[model samples]
Target: MDLVKFFHMNGGVGDASYLNNSGLQRMGIMKTRRIIEEAISNLCKSNIIKYPKTLVMADLGCSLGPNTLLVGSMVIDEVAKTSQEMGLNPPEVQINLNDLPTNDFNTIFCALHEREKKLNTEKITDVHYSPPSCYFTGVPGSYFGRLFPAESLNFVHSSYSLHWLSQLPKLREINKGNVYLASTTPESVSKAYYEQFQADFLQFLRCRSEEMMVGGRMVLTFAGRTTEDPRGEESYYYLWRPLAMALQEMVSEGLVDEVKLDSFNLPWFTASPTEIMKLVEIEGSFTIDHIEIFDVNWEAWKTKKYDNDNDNDASTDDNGVGHAVAKSVRAGIETLVANHLVKQ
Candidate 1:
C-alpha cells in the first residue's frame, strides 16, 4: 500500500471516524499522561533552562481529534505546574501538532480556538488556573524525516503512531496469506519487517535529535510486544488476525478477491523494548531515559455490553472484541482498500 497517502486515520466526525473509533488510543494517552508529566517535570528540573522565554514543543503524529488537544493541554499544564512549584515563571509555549499531509488539520484548527475559549470560560477565581500562553500551529508532514529546525524543540511527544512504518517492506509477497507478521510467515518475512522498523525508527530518532536542543526530552507510547518474537500476542496481530480471518471468509464467499487479499498487508510493525533500545543505542542521539510497558484489554473500549450477563460470556466477549477491532481497523484502512479495489 502507498503508506504516505493511504495510512491516515479515518477523518471527519462521522461514527466511523478516528474521533469515534479512537477510544482505546485515548485511553492509552490517559494512562501515559503521568509518565508524560514526569518527563516534562524532569526536563524542567534538569536545569535545562532557567525559565526560558519560549518552550517549543511538538507532538509528532498528532492526528486530528479531541485526544490531540487533550494531550497538548496536559503537557502545557504540567509545564506550568512544574514551573510554578520551582518558583520559575512558565515559558510561553509554541505547540506544534503534526501528522501526515492528508490529515484533517481543519478540524484540529477549529477545535484549537474552541479549546482556548473553554479554558478562558473556566477561569473563575483570583487564583483560578489559566493555561500557559501558548501558540498552536499545524505541521503537515511525516515524522520519519526532519520536520523542524535544528535545536529548536524543548519537548517531543508521540502516542500510538510509531508502530506504523513509513512504508511496507520490499519483500511484500513473502507473507502471502497473512496481512501482518504471523506464525505462518517465513523467517525472511519477519526479518524484513524488523529491518524496516529499525530503519524507519532510527531515521525518526535522528530527525528528532537534530530538532531538539540539549537536555530536551521525549515521551512515546505505542503498541509494542513484550516478547522478542515478532508474532507475539502483544503485537498488533491481535487486531489484524481477526480482520484477516474475516477477509478470508469474504474470499470464500466470493465477496472479495483472493488475489487482492493476499497482496494486501498492513504497513505497520510492533517493536519490542530490546529492538527499540538497540536502535536508540545505535543511533547515538539520545540516552534511554525511561521505558514502560503495559497492556490494554481488547474489549476495554466497549461502552455497552450484553444484557444476559451470562449469555455465553466467553464467546460473546471474544466476538465483541473481534468486532471492535475490525471496526477500528476498517475505519483506518477502508479508504485505501476501496481505492485499490476500484482500480482493479
Candidate 2:
C-alpha cells in the first residue's frame, strides 16, 4: 500500500475524528511547552538586535485536530513575548502546518479565525501592547522528504509524531502473527524494523538540515524506549499485542481471514535516545540541545479530562475505558485497518 497516499489520522469533526479522540496526543503537547518556550526564547535572544524581520516555523506531521495548530500557536505567542521582553519589535510569524497529502488542511484553515482571536485577546494585557501579525500555510507532504526551501524554517515543533516509519518494514513472512514489534517477534524481524527506522530517521534529519536556517531550534516529542535492547519488552511494543490477539480471535471465529491477519503490519518503530543520538551524529546536520525521556500512564491519560468538551465518544470514565481506547486507535488507523480487512 502507498502509505503516503493513504496514511493520515482520521479527519473531520465527529465522534471518531482525530480532533476529538486525541486527548493523549494533547497531553504530550502540553509536556513540551516549556521546552518550546525555551527554544523560542533563545531564538529571540540570539538574534534580538539584527535577526530577520520574519520568523518562520513549522509543525511537522500536524494531523487534523486541536493539536494541528496548538503548538504552533504556542511558539508564535512565545516569540512575540520574548521579542517584546528583549525590547525588540515582534516579527511577522509565518507558520507552516505539514502533514500527508490526505490530511485535513481545510480544518486547519477554518480554525485560524478562532486561533487569531485568542492570540489577539491574550496579547492585550496592556492597551499599549501589540501582538505580531501571524500567518498560516498548509504544507501537505511527507516529512521523510524535503517540503520547504533551503534554510527557510526558523523554529520547528513536532509533537508525538517521529516514531512513525516512512513505510512498513520488509516483513518477508516474518512477524507473521503480529502487527508491530512484540515480545513474540523473532530477532530477525526486530532487526529489520530497527534498520528501517535507522534509515528513515536519518533521512528525516537530512531533509530538516537543509530546511532549517543557521542556529534555528527544534523541539521534538515522540515515543521512545530507554532500554539498550531494541527488541526488549517495552510498553509501546506491548501496547499493540491486544490488537493482534483480537484479529486472531476474529480469525478463530471465521470473522477475518488468517491470511489477511498474517499480512498486516503497522509502520511504526520506537528508537532509544542513544539510537537517535547516533543518527543525529551520523546525519551531521543538527546537534541535540536538550533531550529527555518521560513516561505517561497510557491507561491514565485515557481517563484524564480532555482539553475541551466534545462528544468524541472517547469516554474518560472508568466504565468506558476500553471503548475510549478503541475509538482513539480507530481515529489513528481506521482507514488502514479497513483496507486491510476488506481487500481481496
The number of the candidate with the highest lDDT is 2
Q: What global local distance difference test value does model 1 have? A: 0.79
List, residue by residue over 116-204, the lDDT tens digit for candidate 2. Answer: 67766774657646568888899999998999999999988888789988888886546777888776778888888899999998898
Residue 140 error for model 1, in Å?
0.4
Clashing residue pairs in all predictions, respectively, total 0, 0
Model 1's number of clashes is 0
Predicted candidate 1 versus true structure: per-residue lDDT over 1-344, tens digit per residue: 66677567888877667766666677677778788889888877886456577888899899877778877888788878887787777778899999998888888888888887887787556463445789998998999988999999989999999998888788844576778888888788788888999899999999998999998989898788889999765564567777777778888888888878777777788898999999999999889877888776555555423221221111123446666666677767777667654344
Worst lDDT run of 10 residues, candidate 1, spans: 306-315
Shift of residue 304 alpha carbon in model 1, Å: 9.3
Worst 10 residues of 2 by lDDT: 306-315
